[model samples]
Target chain A: MHPTSDKFIPFITPETRHFWEGTKLGELRIQKCDSCGHKYFPPRPFCPKCSSKDISLVLCSGEAKLYSYVISHLPAPGFKPPFSIAVVELLEGPRLMSNVIGCPQTPSSLLLDMPLAVVYEKLSDEIILPLFKPTEKIV
Target chain B: MKNQKLVVIGAAETTSLGDIPHLSQVQLHADGALNALADAGLKISDVDGIATAGENPITIAQYLGIHPEWIDGTSVGGCSFMMHIRHSLSAITSGLCKTILITHGESGKSRIPPPEWPWPPRPGSYEGQFEAPFGTMGPPDLLTIPFLRYMEDYNITVEDLAMVPVIQREWAALNPKAWFKEPITVQDVLDSKMIAYPFTLFMCCPRTDGGGALVITTEERAKDLPGKEVYVLGAGESGETMLISQMQDFTTSRAFKTSANRAFLEAGIEREDVDHLMLYDAFAHLPIYGLEDLGFCERGEAPNFIRDRNTAPGGRLPVNTNGGGLSYMHSGMYGMYAMQESIRQVRKVAAAQVPDVKISVAHGIGGMFSASGTVIFSNQPN
Candidate 1:
């Protein structure tokens, strides 16, 4: 497993360790409530809806649609400048906010309601960050 | 189901609204509370009920000197004190307690650095540890997300966003208590440095130092004693504060709309019905965003809604008559000042006071977008 320690640190709490580990294996994962079959994000233990502990980890199809995005040009501490942060609505329903790479970083290239697909990169010893590239440009 | 009624009969404020080196946060609160007690013609002991937004040296029950029969510490936003008026109204009518006092103080401006107190934990601390790590630090920056979306979807523009601080400065020109009194123009706002995209330096409220106190009681208690009586006709509170502060989705501010709706409906008023409007301005964009959210205008049209000085001195709603957080003293929080401004308008003593204010709507938002509270003030009850 490659770790991206020099680039950024992944927040590893007891609840989200599995999702991080799955990223290392090149698999996209999400939690589904066993009781109500609800899919959740950022990974959580009990079902937020019913508080039921019954849940299962499932691999999600690495596809989503771009709902919204911001083209930030300022230079921050870790993340690269001129990067675009996006909120991608998974085909499942819940929206995940993350940065989109692999596509040309330009305002015109970043269209609303654009289709996106996720690709995980193992950068270093203990890190795996997901990057989304424009695919299908769902317009 | 009917909601509770709250009325503010007496109040007082500190004139030394700048840094006063010797006074502590408790002392600041004490100064305001003491004046409030005098305004109500009530003693420290007379206020059996005390309410606060957070724990302070002046606890509802342990302020300055005595204890009260009941205590309520409800802190929503700049509207927290106003919300207490709603609470006190119910408590007084329900035979709970009499003479409810709400107080606030912070040596923000006068002191080089302010002092901390043995108070409650900071509200919305989650955003800092979890959300801020990936950006979204302050309200102005975080809120820019929605502003960007508004730019994409509506007529609101960078120039429109500039109007917020421009008007705030105009009001501050009349308000002596305001920290900044210089006359300004929309061009000045456009010329200021950008704190973030679509928002300039003037687009944010200044950090102010001051305290506000309001005495809430029922008609039975108001039969005697001093000062002008300001009645609360409607009040409500709501939030999309749970998972995130700013409405991450940017569709709308459900919390703001929900509370404003209840207050307006209960007060039996419309946007055009009210003569005065006091919307929080911690971020100048707050009113611009709130105006659109509260139905004063169509979605994505906040920029054009406040195009001119119509809502200024002689304009549409006569908003933020006290200079607001931008020009007026913001104190540590915007809610306290909002309450103070409402009372001033009701008393006809505002530096920028408007005429024929039979109805007033005040709005406040906590955290980045934690919770929003609303109160409708009228000359009479519903």
Candidate 2:
């Protein structure tokens, strides 16, 4: 894996350490409430839906649908131009922001509601970002 | 709060707008405060309350030589000033303060030294952890990502989206104070340089330097003031998410709906009652979302409403009559400017003043739909 510290990195906090650890292990982890069976993203301590502390980390199917996106013409630090910044709706019913890889970054190529699967890119030893790509597999 | 009447007795932008490399961020706040105070025919000593965002209230109070009994530092985002207005209304009605001065100033383009923080938020913060890691550059990137989904779901074409700025530019051409006064067409918008997909350079607000302020007092005191009183008929504010990606729905703004609905309920007015409007336009899509979420049009119909010239110069509802943040002058926090235009319309002194505008609604978005605030103003006391 190539070490890329130039990119933005998440400061691992106690609450978010589990999700990051899961990402490093190739598992997409989100919080699910045991009390209300609610699922949420970005790794909060409690369930957003039920405000329940009775929550646990659940593995995502790593399958998703392209909910929305924008292609950047401006340059950023780690990414090249014309890359798509997307929010993918996971099969588990929560949406998260990621880049869509393995496809051309254009309106014609990145179809809305198209099936996508997750692919993790190792940013650094501690950080692995979840990106997505178009898939032919029926969802 | 409803029993008593609170009115904006004084309002003014900085003495000069557009570019002021000389005025530091805090200095812009002081200038706006002083000008608004002058407009109200009062001295700094007359102000008993102070509220500001983008700069600390404590700092601004000391800088303006005001010993405020009440202070607010509600720094939500650009719309923080709108929240300040809402809070000031409550504070004045509660007798927490007698006179409130809300100030907003930003050296967004100038980037003056000190009190300014570093960009690309540090790690350990929520945004740094989740949002920043994705290589999002700024509001133009993050705030605009959701539009594609909205377009797909609503079956809106790119041509429909271009009309928002086109109509707003028409309003801009009439206002001499506006930054971009040149008229532009939908094809012009499409022909401009693309900054982000589906968003061209012309569609985004210019990074300009400016500031604005407002002075609020009860109607009883306003009678002795120097300017026409624009009464705060009703006001409401709400927050949706800290991150744009977390917004509940891409097609509409829950925060805009919740805030404006509360304002309408409090004002006791319907959509038809409002003759003028100022929907913040940091990006072209905001007015589109604002129209739908604020209940001016049905969901997914705002594009056509705008394209049909319903919001244009001769349109039924004159929106963004000040050219808005898009062309007017967005100096970082645009909520102040939005409210200023509403007050100007209600005062009948606007550059493109709509005839018989008894009521005007100013709606603003804080940070990438993170928070929202709506204020309904009326020339009539009732």
Candidate 3:
């Protein structure tokens, strides 16, 4: 069968299945090192700082801040030109790449250090992505 | 190892610089390896060790039909060549191998088939799971994202960032092999087509097909060769994170700082002692980060230092004299080309030669500030 073009699909792994599941459930999930109390993004089984296998999956506050970003003028498959590709810093002390939707993708509109909240995007039956959006309400 | 002196006996790029559609990727590696061996006045049979990145060392060795005792296929990213240099020093000094050859080549612009990696990565890989869903395809998207945070924190203007390519173009204007040789202005960089925010097309390195190689050996052996010897005084390699967002800080690359510091310490040279510098410029912001992270300037000072013409032509520190990745040719892996320019400067034969360059530093970043390698070359070993 011929596959569809202009679509972004993320692969789910055994270690990361929980992350996709949480996103589909409208929850933002992150990994935490139970030994060191260090929260990290982009799920891995072991702790980055302490190398502790004593890690747990926890629901995040869904709160973040716009740490950095760039509005791409060049077109990418499944993305419109001039959309923000950003790094959002979670309040739990981990940062991840995401898009700032529900706002103009402009430098003036997307201010640095601005408060953000997680919004899930269901790409397919198997994958769900956690995106970000600006918010005035404090967590 | 400290007592043993190591030198680069051979250095050369592919026969042609850019726009070679006929050569396959692996063939490009062979072309560069062959040219570098020729420059050293040696044959492939004369080599006892092989090290390469991008292409597998085993493939490269078998392709050249040389069986070696030491092989390093350390593939991190563009900076893999730098790490290869660091490893080759250890292998040669420890008597593991003599006459080590490090090569690099890529069909970046040609789109040669085979070994093609799918976009968005596979579902199970870390990058595929995290970065790809965000539309981060290549360097322009992912690498340039961090600059805005740096600029905001440092209060640097877009005009200051534009000066990086402008000054490098001045150097490229002197070098005949550079891809973009025309001298441009800050206005011109701003006016060029924008690829990503804070990064115009002029600010990004051009995608072109090219390759370069280096032959390293003991100083005693290099003396027998016809080429001038560029001694490897010190080298360092460091890694941070594969994920760009996981980087400790957006403003500074921890890997860059760690690698550069280790290199400078081992070289026993102060920043002022460096006669020339080659900070890989995959994007305009890279050199800025290099200037500060490498300790050439203080935090939040590189933009102004560059704007003040400190790193430009006739400035105190001559940087990217071979036009760098931005103006010089940027194959997929750029570290080899960066090292070639440093070797040329130390040899006193560079197209845009820095006068009396006794010491030179080549710093490279791999995979979006994820990894770094720094090498120091000198005409004299202390």
Q: Which lDDT tens digits does candidate 3 get at residues A1-139? A: 1224344677677888888889879988899999999888888899988999999998889999999999988777788889899999999888989999988888888999999989877677767778898997332
Give the per-residue lDDT digits (tens) of candidate 1, residues B1-382: 1444456777788647765667766667778888887877888877777877644424535546767776767765456676676667677878788777888776666643444421222322333222433433345455455555655665455777778888777788888777888988888987876565556778777666678787887755676777677788777777675334225446567878888887788777778877888888887667876887787877766666676576787887788888888887776566777877877787788788788777777888776566788887766665
Best first by TM-score, ranked: 2, 3, 1
TM-score of chain A of each: 0.87, 0.93, 0.91
Of the two candidates 2 and 3, the one with more favorable TM-score, higher being better, is: 2
* TM-scores, all models, native as reference: 0.83, 0.98, 0.97
Docking band of candidate 3:
medium
Error of 3 at B192 (Å): 1.3
Interface RMSD of candidate 1, in Å, is 4.9
Instruction: State the lDDT at B269 in candidate 3.
Output: 88
Against the true structure, whose DockQ is highest?
2
**Which residue runs of candidate 2 sit more than 4 Å off their true CA positions?**
A1-5, A137-139, B114-118
Which one wins on lDDT?
2
| Candidate 2 CAPRI-style tier | high
CAPRI quality band, candidate 1: incorrect
The lDDT ranking, best first, is 2, 3, 1
- What are the lDDT scores of the predictions, listed in order? 0.69, 0.89, 0.89
lDDT of 2 at B348: 94
1 or 3, greater by lDDT = 3
Tell me candidate 2's TM-score on chain B: 0.98
